[model samples]
Target: MSRLATSVTAALVVAIVTSWTTVVGDARADTARTQPCTRYTAILAPGTWETHIDADPAVPVGMLRPLGDGLQWQFGRDITVLYAPYAASAFDQGLTYAESLSTLEATLHHMVATLCGSTRVVLAGYSQGADGIGDLATEIGNGAGPISADRVVGVGLLADPHRDPDTTLSLGNPQPGDGIAGARSQDFGALTERVRTLCADGDLYCSLNATASPFLSALGKVLSGDPAPIAYLIPAYTDPGTLIEQAVTVGAGWAATAANLPTILEGLDTLPRLLTSGDIAAAHQIASGLNAALSPMVQAAASVDLTLVASVIRAAAAVDPSGWTSAASVIADALAYVDIQRIAFTAGHIQETLWRTMESLTRNDHLQAAAELAVLTPSVFDLADATLGPLLTAVRGDLALAVDTLLDIGGPESIDELVQLARQGAALASFYGSNAHIDYAEDVQTLLGFLRTQVAS
Candidate 1:
C-alpha cells in the first residue's frame, strides 16, 4: 500500500481503538478509584496528538491506554494509574513539543506533591510523551526532580526520543542507534536501575542512526528544547572566537546566495527557451549571466557547513527568554521539516550543471548546452519553491531516503545512486510514522509485566 494509504488506515485504526479504550479506561478508572489509596501510583503520559490539554484523566488514550488499563487490572487497589493531561500537540497544533513538555512536567510535579508519603511512583510514556518523561526521570534520578530516587519504583519509556541504549536498559528487538532527539547527556543516575526503554527495530524516533544524520539528530535536540547535543555534535568549535567567525562565514554565504537567487532563477527560466529556439548567442548570454549570478551562491553553498549552523541554533536555544531565542526556536523547528540534504544535493547539481553548460557554450556545443540547461531549469525552480513547512508536506518521502542514503553510503557517488538510496531510505524512515510506534502496547507487555513485578516487590 502507498505510505499515505497506510498512514490513513493507521489513523483510522487508532481512532477506533482510542474511542473504545476511552470507554474501557473510564470503567477501569471508576473501579480503581473506589478502592483505598494504593501503595504505588503509575503516572502515564500519552504521545503527541494523543490527548488534549484538558483531557479527562479517567480516560487514558493512545498507545499507553493499554498499559494503563493493564496496570489497573493487575493491581486494582494496589496501584493508581493516572493518565497525565497535557497539550499533547505537535508544533503546529497550538502548543509546541516544548510547551507540552512543560505541561507534562507540571502534571508530574503536582502528582508527586499530592501523593501519600508512603506511596511509590512508576512513570510510563510513549513517543514525544516519552521524551518528557525521560527528561523528568533523569532529573529525579540526579536528585533534582519532584520525587526522590527511592520513591520511584519503575519507569517505562516506549519509543523515547531521548533514548540512549548506552545508559538505559533496552527491551525487545535491538535497534540501530539512540533516539532521534539524541540520548540524554546525564544518565538516569540513581534511578538508572529502575528505568527501562523499549524501541521497536524500525522506529526512528527512538532509534535514529546518529552518525548518518547528525544534522537531523541535532535538529531533534533543538526541537526538544535541549542544547546539550550541540556541544557533543560540534565539539571542535568550542572557542568563542572561532565559533563566531564560522557563523559569520556561513551567514555571509547564505546572504550572497539569497541575493543572487532571483537573477539565477530568471536566467534559468529564460535560458531554456533561448536554447530551444537555436538562439545560440542568446543562450550563451543567458548561461554566462546564470554562471555569474550562481558563482557566488555556489561558492557560498559549498562552504556552508550545516553542522555549524545547528550549533549556532543550539546556542540560541540556550539563551534566556527573548525575541531572538523564540525566533531561533521557530527557525530550528521549521528546519526540522526541511529536506536539507536534498537542498544540498540540488545546490551541488546546479553548480555542476552550470559548469557543464558554460563549457558546452565555449565549445560551440549549443545542443549539449541546451540539454544541460534544461536539467538545470527544473532544479532551479524546485530550489526556488522549497519553503518552510511540515516535513510531510514539504519533502514527503524524499527526506527519509536522502537521510538514509547519507547514512548508508556516507555520501552518494552520483545523483542516480542518491535517488536509488532515497527509495530505500523512505521505507526505513516511514517506520517512524507507522503503526510500529503505536502498537508498542502489545510489544511491551513483557516490560509492563516487569514493572508490575518491580512495584510489587
Candidate 2:
C-alpha cells in the first residue's frame, strides 16, 4: 500500500481510537506521522540517514518536520521522532520494564534499518527525553526508568544530568541508574564517549533553564542606566567587502550557536534542583569546583575570537546569582564557554581538532573524571537537557554532514538564513512553551538579539 494509503488507514484508526480510547492530543496527533513518508521520515530511509529526536510534550500537537536546515520550507526523506502517548495505558499498564525507552530506541533504530536499509540514525533526545536516559515513553517525565537503547549509530541528549546520584538522582533527575551513585552517564552512550558540559551560572530562577545572563546582562545594563558597551565595540563592525571571506566564515550558519546556548543554560540549572536543599552550601561548592576543573578548555582555545573565548568563561561564571555582579556577566561567561567550543568546530582549520578535543574529554579514566566533575563537583553535563539541541546533533555528525548545504541554504551572508536559524531556534523554544506552559517568549527574544548581532567581521 502507498504511504498515503497507510496514513489514511491510520488516520481512520486514530479517529476511532480517539473517539473510543481517549488518546487525544500530541500522541494521537503524531499518529498521522506513522505514514511511510518520504518527505521527512524518508530522510531516515534506512541508508539515507537522519536524526531521531524526541519531541517535547509541549511541542505542537501534530507531525512536525523541519525543512531546509530547519530554516525554510523544503523537504526530503523524513526522520521519525516518536512521541510519548498520553493515554493512561502508556503508564498504567502499557510500558513494562523490558519495554524500556531503550527498547523503543532499539525498535526505532531496528525498524529504520530493517525497513529503511541500515539507516544511520542519530538518537537526539530532549528534556525528559534526556533525563530518562534510555527510558520508555511513559516512564519519562516523572519516573525512575531506563531508556532501552542499543545498536544506534549516534545519540544526543539535552539538558540531562550527570551529577552525584547520592544527592537526588531519583525519579526526576536525569542521572542514569537506580540504586547507584555514578551511573549518571552509564546509559548515555553519546556523552560516555564524548562529554562536553558548557554551563551558565544563574539559570534556576525560571525553572525552564533557558535563561541567559548575557542577554540578561544586556538588559541589566539597559535597566541600570548604563549604555551598551557596544559603543566601544560597534565601531569595529567590518564592512561587508572586507568581511566577505572572514565574516562569511565566522557567521556561516552560526545561528546554530544561538539555538545551542539556551539548551546548555537550562541543562546547567538542574544542579540546585538535583541537590538536596539541605546541602545548598555543598551544591554551591560543587558548582564552583566543576567550573574550576573546566577552566583549562577556554585557555586551550584562546586563539579564537573574543566572543568564543568569553562564552567558555561564562559557562562557569553563570553558576549562581550572588557570585557574579549581575546576570549579564553570567550570560557572557557561560556563553563564552559554549560559543568557544562551537567556534572551534566552525573554524575550518580547527573543527576536527575541537571535536577530537571534546571527545577526548570522555576517554578512559578521564571519562569518569569529567562526568564526575559535572555530576559530583558541579555537573555542567546537566546543561545537556535543554541546550543539547545543536551539540548533540552536531556531535552525531549528521547535521555536520549538511555543513556545506546548511551553509548554502542558510547562506554565508544572508541575514534571512541567520533569522531562520534563530526562528528555528525559537521554534525549538516553542516546545518548552508548549510542554511546561511558561511564557518563554524570551527564549525567542534571546536568540533574536544574537541573530541581529553581526558577529561575522
Candidate 3:
C-alpha cells in the first residue's frame, strides 16, 4: 500500500479502537455500580463542604471516613460500602439545606432500588449529613420511603440537627437541649429502635436553648426548609398588641444604640491611631468592646422588620397623635428612603466582617487583624454615613421622647428589659464553637461496635 493510505488507515484504526475501549470501560463501571451485594450494604453521607456532587464513591472523606473504613475492614468481602455523592453545602455557601436534602434522598433511593431486597442496609452521616440521614430514616420508617423500613439494619448520626431525644437512641452524655434546628415533627416510626444519634455537649448545631429564645428557634426552622415558624412570626409582628411590644422593643434597641454610639464612634476614631501607634493589644481590646456593643445592633438590624416597625409607629401615632406625632415624623422620615432588605443585607455583611475582625484579633494575627479592620472600618463608616447616620442622630437627639411615645402606646414599662430579651434571642443563634461536633472520630469505635452488633445479627 501507498505510505499515505497506510498512515490514514492506521490513524483511523487507532481512533476506532480508542473509542471502543472507552465505551467498554464506561459499561464496566456502570455494571460495577449497579452490582448488588449478597449480605449487606452501608451508605454514608458526609457533612457540608466535605464532599462534592461528583465525588468518587470509592474514596470516603470527611467526618464519617473512619466509620466507612471500619465497616469495610470488619465486613471485608461480605459487604459493600458506598459513599453518597451530593452538593453538601449550606445556603450561604452554595446550595440550600433543602437542595442538599433532595440530592441525598435521591441518592439513597437509587441505591435502595438497585440493591437486593434481602441485603440489609446501614446508613451513617455527620452534621448536615446527619440531618439528611435522620430525615430519610423518618420517611422510610413512616412507610413512604424508597425501601421497607426492615431493610435498614442500622443507622448512626453525629450532630443531627433534627435529633429528637424522645425518639432516637442517644449515645453520648445527655445534651442540654435538642438540636439547634429543633426536633423532627414526626417520629421515626418503625426505625425508631434501629436509629441512633450522638451529640457532643456544647455543640450548638445539635443543642440550642430553643425555649429561652423562640425567635432563634424560629429562625433555625426557617433555615432548615420549614416555613411554618415564619407564618407565626409574621402575625406576631403585625398584631396590635405585638406591634406595640415590638415598637417598644425596637425603640429600646435605638435607645441602647444611642447610648453606645459615642463609645463605638470614639473607638472607631481611636482604632486607627492605636494601630498606627503599634498598640495592638489596646486595639484588640477596643475591637472586643466594639464587637460586644455592636453585635446586638447588627443582629437587630438584620432581624427586625423596619417596615413593620414603621407601621406600628404609624398606628401608635394615629391612636395618640399628641404623644407620637414628632417621634413618628422622625422615624418615618428616616425610614422613607431606607431599603429594608438592603439594610438587612448590609447589616449581615457588617456583622460577619466584624466577627472576622474580632476573631483575627483574638488569634493575635496582627497582619490579618489589620487587614480585616481596614475592610471593616470603611464599611462601617460608609454604613453610618449612608444608612444609619440619620436614624442614629434622631435617636440621640430625642431619646426620651421616643421612649415616652412607646410607653404612651402602652407596652413594657422598661424598654431596656425588652431589648435585653431581644439580645438574648440573638445570642441563641450564635454558634457555641464546640469541637465536639467535628470530633466524630473519637466516637467512631462506639459507632462501629454498634453497627457490628446490629449487622451480625
Predictions: Cα RMSD each:
14.0, 27.6, 16.6
Segments of candidate 2 deviating more than 4 angstroms: 1-75, 78-115, 133-153, 162-457
Candidate 3 per-residue lDDT over residues 196-228, each given as its tens digit = 888876676677666554333433545555322
Clash count for each candidate, listed in order shown: 0, 62, 0
Best by TM-score: 3
**Candidate 1: minimum summed lDDT over ten consecutive residues — where?**
415-424
How far residue 304's Cα lies from its native spot in candidate 3, in Å, is: 14
lDDT of 2 by residue, 196-221 (tens): 11111211211222122222222222
Model 3 RMSD in angstroms: 16.6
Which is better, 1 or 2, measured by TM-score? 1
Candidate 3, 111: how far from true, in Å?
Answer: 1.8
Candidate 2 residue-wise lDDT at 158 = 31
TM-scores for candidates 1 onward, in order: 0.56, 0.23, 0.58
- Candidate 3 TM-score to native: 0.58
